[model samples]
Target chain A: MTLALPAAEAARELVEPVLREAVARLDPLTARVARYHFGWADSDDRPCAGGGKALRPTLAVLSGRAAGADVERCLPAAAAVELVHAFSLLHDDVMDDDPVRRHRPAAWTVFGRSHALLCGNALLTLAGELLLEQETPGCAAAARALNEAALSLMAGQALDLEFQGRDDVTREECLRMSRCKTASLLACACSIGVTAAGGPASLAGSLAAFGAEAGLAFQLADDLLGIWGSTEATGKPVLADLRTRKKSLPVVAALTGPTAAGRRLAELLARPEPLAESDLHDAARLVEEAGGRAWAEAETGRRLDAATRHLDEADLPADVRAEFLHLARFIATRDH
Target chain B: MTLALPAAEAARELVEPVLREAVARLDPLTARVARYHFGWADSDDRPCAGGGKALRPTLAVLSGRAAGADVERCLPAAAAVELVHAFSLLHDDVMDDDPVRRHRPAAWTVFGRSHALLCGNALLTLAGELLLEQETPGCAAAARALNEAALSLMAGQALDLEFQGRDDVTREECLRMSRCKTASLLACACSIGVTAAGGPASLAGSLAAFGAEAGLAFQLADDLLGIWGSTEATGKPVLADLRTRKKSLPVVAALTGPTAAGRRLAELLARPEPLAESDLHDAARLVEEAGGRAWAEAETGRRLDAATRHLDEADLPADVRAEFLHLARFIATRDH
Candidate 1:
């Protein structure tokens, strides 16, 4: 946890300038949208201070460092990952109809949905252009990784939206969606960092394995926070997922569980009207009673352990391994 | 026009299979959405016969042929351009809220806006991946061209949307938007086709100039049809752009003209209520009286002439030059 803030800050310091440069390559209108979305500008186009946590870029740069590359050499790959993350968030916020992001109105709410969508696409294109401009063989491999992860991310989002309309979403289906939605990009970030650093495919594979496990753990923690974390800590309303009847891991686990509480949870969720505060509380209790909370907490520990094993097995210096572990642990246990 | 239909058919036969194969890579839910968007599948998930004109792909393949390469070497580039075109159309439909495309309900209308947007993104990623998988150095240049064109296209769309709210859009601004939104992709298509065929940058440059001029001519023709063509030809209600108050080239020219007809046209367009059928006819007449239609017609002819001159100067076989001219003329004069 201690290394987490410093690692993110360092990554942001190196990558944000490159990201800004890439966004500036867009047309003035699109550039304004990109700046506002990235928290470099407010809705009125003034400078702001609400950028992202830079977690993905941190992983990219650290993974490169662990593979014996200089930080400057990793800047393009790191910035690419951060741009992809921002692109997905922009589109996902519009699709999910969520009105807030990072303690402010979402980009779609500020700029309108069409502009947000177009700007997201512009960022994505810029991400690829950044890698291509590097003109290195390793950059080509990194670009391929980014493309594969982007495809998986879109497919995962499609599934997530599809699940919203159905009550029969299975645990396996939810797991698959989560793997694509969260783990694939994280895995790509780790692997592409090393790939861009001229690491062998085998080494990238090991790092990717570590990242995927850590990513799942992060998702579990995120879902738990959706139900129980403080609004200040999570930048969302308390029990926000339940109020929106989101089919997160715990909710799906409880919905498909073999218990009376599970059936009641489903019934509560199936009602056509929006859930009242009392109903949201009742649903949270039912999810716990059906053993969903216990299962998720235990599974999170298992994933974290698997992730640590990956780092332990990778041929990295002790300090590099510690940094990876600190980052994984920090994301999985942030304020919870 | 005789060569036009045959060339398009040839390109479709070569490129559609590859395009279909690339789309098949998406996860099932997303793949379904993609299939629907491409007109390979109906809304009920059954196979359908409705697809695009394959104009961009034809241009890509023909440009390669004109650059002294075999058609097989150009398939990937052709498919990549087609995918980019489809991606833009998907997003553009959502942004413009146009309910139809190519004689059918638009993808956003049938699959919902969110799925349409995601599927569009999926196609875009697929386009880049298609280039990378070729493993040829020429494909790298093609990828760069595609990325640049995609960015310009987005910028143009943003401007187009911004113009929807304003009454002071200049003729220069409209021309710039048309260049970015329409000409850029077509230029990329021609340049990438030549680049992918191992042609020099100079050759690609000439073909891109030809394609850009042809593309502007195509846009001018399309805008005219938007105002005057039959539904059977343009696949929308008559005067569709007028109904939506689209600031197309001729409309902008008329609105900014120094004639009384121009002033009357502006007042008519600025009214809050929807225009009646008679009003649409009157507006169309005003555009003509104000010299907008005459100006656009003359410009289209000039662009087509320039495009043909570029083809004549390029070191292409006689038949290849003829084919390119035929395609350009066909698009510029379709059903007009």
Candidate 2:
């Protein structure tokens, strides 16, 4: 996904140094694991151009500006949110047993499960340490927000794990899990910026709402990509989610869809054997035919609209609001 | 181990409800996992009598009193320390791939590794949440201490994992691991009480030192029990550490000793086959013959003495000093 918005790009650049400094505070062993995971260095500690898009930190920076706070003053909040994101990624890799992330072998694959797990724990504590180090007017409130978000994130992950290999998982359960697993941290990322800046609680709450909707849209789009996006773009094999039998949004929607195609999809999924390449191709087509693709597309648009409404209600400065608008659009439309 | 000291018993009783309340703050799924792990409930949620001796929380409460604060005011800090300890146990069980804990199936065995891991993460965040809820004097300092301890604890666990299946691990490395994995949290437990109570830095530092030495003594004693203690008393299989080829203090001591028995012990450990009962017995005998048993005993005594000296140097009230001394002795002497 291209970051066409110069302001978003600038915010990401602004957050990079703060994120590096915060991660650098970990002990040597954990720091190596974290740095390798972040794509800052290879497993051997050589430099590599690897890492996520820094979307969450940019959201924090923009939210701080939208709340009339200096972006510099909101840096700790930005770093804390990014650290939480990294912590989740590390743990999620282990939980999903994913072999690859960001087009490379996952951290757990390189460092071993135990080291990856401990490094994730260390990163989590470091997030709290960074927030406490802020030592500013609203640091306590920001810390509280971050901790609450972290609890919800883990709870969401528990629910996701619970849903695995279960045939009865409902659409409502999937949506709630998504909210907890993805949306909660993103919402916190938006709100913590405002709280750190000592902005009005109302604005913070509104931004959180905005972010929650944006996060849902983001996840829905990702679910679509998991099944239908190009392998070259996603850095994953074709229909990788289908191969793993992952009950992602689109798959769940298709399984629960009250149609012949949906029933056929269920029968295909319930087979004891692993899905072959031909089976995956058929499953993808069945998901599309079962209205899963259309449903997710509609939901993504609906959530994006809801997110924009929250942003509008937040009454941000015109320029800041436009920047947020661009970001929300980017999240909803990004292909990779 | 019986709590013969009246004050130690009182401190434990006082901290129990606070710990329960802090854990109760977790979301329903994580709470169920944590409750099951703590032996508060069976896997099916039926009531059960389970859990560790509330050692860490009692230490926090007693340390607060020794630092000239009311035990009631130290409840949050006490609960936070206990939660951290429980978090470590849950994750450690996963890392060790152990099947039982406290004479029951381990949490990961019942709930699966993902649930246990997430529950541990939830408990950790809850500790931060509990400390933040205090909003009283010195809360930030207490939170900082807890975070630091958590980082050290994870680092220590990483080191322990690294040492596994490796024969070259040194005595110094084992001691450093013990300090980080066990003593760091204990030290935090002690210092957090003083920080929570707004006590002097000197007293806090001294109490932390006392706890560090006590923790080392406690671990050394535990290593002895792992080899020679009764199965009924320790609620573990005979020579459990040796069965797992764990590089505990005594084992490392035996391996590094410059003697024929030590060399023989190393050869036995290097074998690919699992140790039979007779092999375990022989290994135990060799450890003693190689002077591991005597060395650990002497070191435990030295640490206990050093711990007592730190406690005395803190200038606590005579009554409080007596209680701390009694607790330290109990820790070094406990079997189960």
Quality of candidate 1's docking, in CAPRI categories? high
Instruction: List the lowest-lDDT window of 10 residues for candidate 1 chain A.
Output: A1-10
Interface RMSD of structure candidate 2 (Å): 1.0
Worst 10 residues of 1 chain B by lDDT: B1-10
Q: For each candidate, give the interface RMSD after superposing the true interface residues on Cα.
A: 0.8, 1.0
Interface DockQ per candidate: 0.85, 0.78
Cα displacement (Å) at residue B4, model 1: 4.6
Candidate 2 lDDT, A135-211, residue by residue in tens: 65487778889999999899888888878769988888999999998999989987888998889999999999999
State which candidate has the highest DockQ: 1
TM-score per candidate, chains pooled: 0.98, 0.97
- What does the lDDT read for residue A183 in candidate 2? 92
Name the candidate that leads on TM-score: 1
Regions of model 1 farther than 4 Å from truth: A1-4, B1-4
| lDDT for each residue of candidate 1 in A1-336, tens digit (9 for 90 to 100) | 223378888888899999998988888888898899888999999997768888889899988988899989999999999889899999999999999988889999989998999999999998898998887778877888899999988988999999999999998898889889999999888778899877978889999999999999999998999998888877889998898889999999998999999999999999999888899899999999998888888888999999988887789977778888888988887765
